[model samples]
Target: MHITSGSALYHYTRSGTSVKKLYEASWVRYCAVNRSGDKIFVTNSMSELLTLSKDGTILSIFTDRQLQSPTAVHVTETGHVLVCWKNTIIQVDIEGNKNVTSLAIPNVDNPLSMCNLGKCIIVGSSNILVLKIE
Candidate 1:
């Protein structure tokens, strides 16, 4: 899957053929596909988390106040969705619930991207912060 600057997500075939447009929003910053590959977690400029189905259907939207200016999102191997909100990493469950744990980076002022490396998560900004997750 790929995202267009115009706030649209597309699914393409392995051979590089465009399958279909998956979803569109006012301003989509980052997205992560769930463990089962059936749902997508998206963070938009509105500081909201959107959960969409594979075929472009909106499933849920989380408008938690803590989602302030989310910059990146990642789906962990264990089925948790991690979102980069300011200097904290918020973990959301697969059901789109926002009442989970959040890890605050010690020195990082802002977090822009993140990747799941098995037992750890690497958050990148001006500097990199790695957190070990069990």
Candidate 2:
């Protein structure tokens, strides 16, 4: 799976001829696929969390007025979705309840990308920021 600007998610088959797409948002900063490959969590530079089925079907959109600049997203092994804002991480449960985490990558100002690596979150930006989580 790969994402292009202008808010598009593309899934390509082996030979690269077959492509599946989800083109519903204006800007998709990052996306994470669930372990079951049944759901996808997407985010932009703003505060909307979009959920989609693997077939590109729109499932749900979650947003919180308190969130600011939600620049990146990651999905954990336990089916929880984590979104990284400027200085916080918003954790969303399957029921859509939002929990904010005061997690950060030290001195980095831009937590623009992220992924789950076992027990830690590997932050993405111009510099590498790795933070361990309980």
Candidate 3:
């Protein structure tokens, strides 16, 4: 689902010939579609994260005090939401209430992209850095 800044929600159907209207919003960005295609995760960019159903209903919104400029989001196999911004990555639980962890890449100059490769996650900016998880 794609939410336009002008307050329109657009979604493409499986048939690829049909389009559906989800809802309206003043601002929306950074959308992550779930594997099941029944739900979508959206980040307001300037604000918090929003979970919306396929039919246009808001399932939940996380308003944690520590969230700042959430620019990138990815969901893990364990159903955890990983948010990346600047030099930090925050992990949020399924309910969006519990914060699992917040990781900061030490001495990162300018991180522009990131990729997860199984046990290691690579972040790229002016230079590429890989972080290994145990």
Give one clash count per candidate, in the order shown. Answer: 0, 0, 0
Q: By TM-score, how accurate is candidate 1?
A: 0.91
In what order do the candidates fall by lDDT, top score first? 1, 2, 3
- At residue 20, candidate 1 shows an lDDT of 89
Q: Tens digits of per-residue lDDT for model 3 on 1-134?
A: 35444345577655554477675556664566566766666767456777778776888887666677666666655466776677877777765556789898776643545557777777776668888875
Better of 2 and 3 by lDDT: 2
What is the C-alpha local distance difference test score of each model?
A: 0.81, 0.71, 0.67
Lowest-sum lDDT 10-residue window in model 3: 1-10
In candidate 1 the C-alpha lDDT for residue 2 amounts to 55
Clashing pairs in 1: none
lDDT (0-100) at residue 31 of candidate 2? 82
Q: Give the TM-scores of the predictions, in the order they appear.
A: 0.91, 0.79, 0.73
Residue 63's C-alpha lDDT in candidate 3?
A: 65
Whole-structure CA lDDT of model 1: 0.81
lDDT of 2 by residue, 58-134 (tens): 78878886467677777887777887777667788753446544454466665777777788878776777787877
Q: List the residue pairs that clash in candidate 3.
A: none
Question: Once superposed on the true structure, which residue ranges of model 1 sit more than 4 Å away at CA?
Answer: none
Q: Which ten residues in a row have the lowest lDDT in candidate 2?
A: 95-104
